[model samples]
Structures are given as C-alpha cells and as structure tokens.
Target: MNRQPEPRQAIALKYDGKQAPTLTAKGDDELAEAILKLAREYEVPIYENAELVKVLARMELGDSIPQELYRTLAQIIAFAWQLKGKFPEGFDPDAGPVERDITPPK
Candidate 1:
C-alpha cells in the first residue's frame, strides 16, 4: 500500500505597522508553488510553520489575523523586519515580549 504525500500549503501576510497582520494570499499545491516562487524571485523571507499556516489559512483574504495569533505572527513579522535591517523602535531580541504594542485599540 502507498500513501500520497500531503499537498504543500503557502500563506502570505501583510503588516503595515498600523494594522493587524492581514492574510494576503493562501493556497495549496500548484498555487502554493506559484506563491512561493514569487517570494523567491522577490527575495522575501519565507517562514514555515505548518500549524501557523493551518490557522492563518482559515482566515479570509483581506482579513486581519485574530488576537490569539498576534504573538505568534508577531515573531514572524519581527524576524522579517530584522532581516531587512528595519527593527522596530525599542525592540529587544532578548526581551520576552515585543517592546512596542502594535495592536490597535479596541
């Protein structure tokens, strides 16, 4: 007996420092490949976390991620920003939490 491999999943997020991280794009299989390819072509850093992807994929396009996912997604965005040498003001990699609270007021 043979088991088929799981299809690859890809998700894209957008954060403008003024809003919650939003689900920009998500797909499986071939579409995932296309999204990943574009990321490579543009030198975008790719973060792979199957659990995170599974959670984020549940959100609709253009929807900001839920509050529960803020801390997890913050790490991803922080790393991406660090890679581009644009660390947020007062951010301390050694700190337990992000120095700045980017979450919008309720």
Candidate 2:
C-alpha cells in the first residue's frame, strides 16, 4: 500500500540582541500550519529549509542551538536581518560590506 508523505515541519527560533537564538516553536502538520499562520499574522519573515528543520526538530523548545550549527544559523539570521533592512546589534555600517558564502549542512 502507498503511504502519504509526512506532513510539513516547521521550527521557529528567536535571537535577541544578547542571547543565542533559541528554539521557540516546532510542529508538524496542522500545528505547522498554525505556526506559519501566526508568523504571517505577525509579519515575521519565513525561511524554508527542510533539512535544517529536520535537524533542528531534534531539540526541545527553548534550547539554544548547538555550537556546531552556529555558522549556518548565523548566516540564516543575517539573511533575515538583511531582508528586514536592519543590522544586528553592534553592526557597523561604516565598516564596509561583509562577505559571506555559507553552505547549508548536508
């Protein structure tokens, strides 16, 4: 018999000026839809990466990301900040452009 694929998964993380990004929400199927809906309602930017979501889904809510994922997550966060046209705290506009070439985990 053919089985349906697993429902879509989503993970949300929040990074304030000080602390590392923490997993705030995670869900599958309808709960995933609700998470996306709330994010849209609040005008939150959504980044889609199924592999990244799969890795992050292993963590319990409120857990800071592992150091191994720091660089990858930083790139994602930086991209989000750029989309919002805002820099992270202590970012120096006068410091000239920063170059980054990030490869997502396999």
Candidate 3:
C-alpha cells in the first residue's frame, strides 16, 4: 500500500532560566516553512521531535508548555545550550540545581 507523509508542523519555544518554555510560534505547511526559514537565518538551534511537535503545535503562542514534557524538552534545551557554549548561571555539575524546573504560568 502507498502512504503519504503528514504536512510539516513547526513550533518555536523560548525558555528562560526562571520560567517554563513558552510557545513563541507555531505553524503548518507554508507557515511552518517560514518559521524554519527564520530559524535558519538567525542560526537558532533546531531540535526536531515529531511527537513533541504535534503536542506543541496545539499550544497557543505565549503558553508555557505543560509539566509532563519537562524532561524531554529539558534535554533538547540542554543540547541547544551546549551548542552555543551557554549555560545557566550558578550551575555547578556537582551541586547545582536541577537543570529544568519551569512551572506553567499561573
């Protein structure tokens, strides 16, 4: 049987050291293309997880991601930070706080 792939879906998230990652943008098809283009132009790190994207695409812009996604998203965020040689302040591998602890905005 022949099968067709799903249309592209993309989401942009912003994470602050103090707060949960927020949904900055989301799109499908052309919009998804545009979002990816901008990310490329800005040299932003892109981490693709089809399953995560599906869940995130459901969120509205400015919404903090749900709690359950923390661990997986944290790993992705850590990867981005590593790529940039950036890390949270006061973080010590031996004694620092856990890397991620963003509560959804009230």
lDDT of 1 by residue, 68-98 (tens): 8887787788789879888778766666753
Assess the local accuracy of residue 39 in candidate 1 as a C-alpha lDDT between 0 and 100. Answer: 95
State how far residue 35 of model 2 sits from its true place (Å).
Answer: 0.3
lDDT of model 2 at residue 17?
A: 50
lDDT of each: 0.86, 0.88, 0.86
- For candidate 3, the 10 contiguous residues with the lowest summed lDDT are 97-106
lDDT of model 1 at position 35: 94
Cα lDDT tens digits, model 3, 1-106, are 8788798999999987778899999999999999999999999999888888999999889999888888778879988997988777866656755655554444
True-structure RMSD, every candidate: 3.2, 4.2, 3.5
TM-score of each: 0.81, 0.83, 0.81
User: Measured by TM-score, how close is model 1 to the native structure?
Assistant: 0.81
* Runs with alpha carbons beyond 4 Å of true place in candidate 1: 90-106
Q: Which rank order by TM-score, best down to worst?
A: 2, 1, 3
Of 2 and 3, the candidate ranking higher by lDDT: 2
**Which number leads on TM-score?**
2
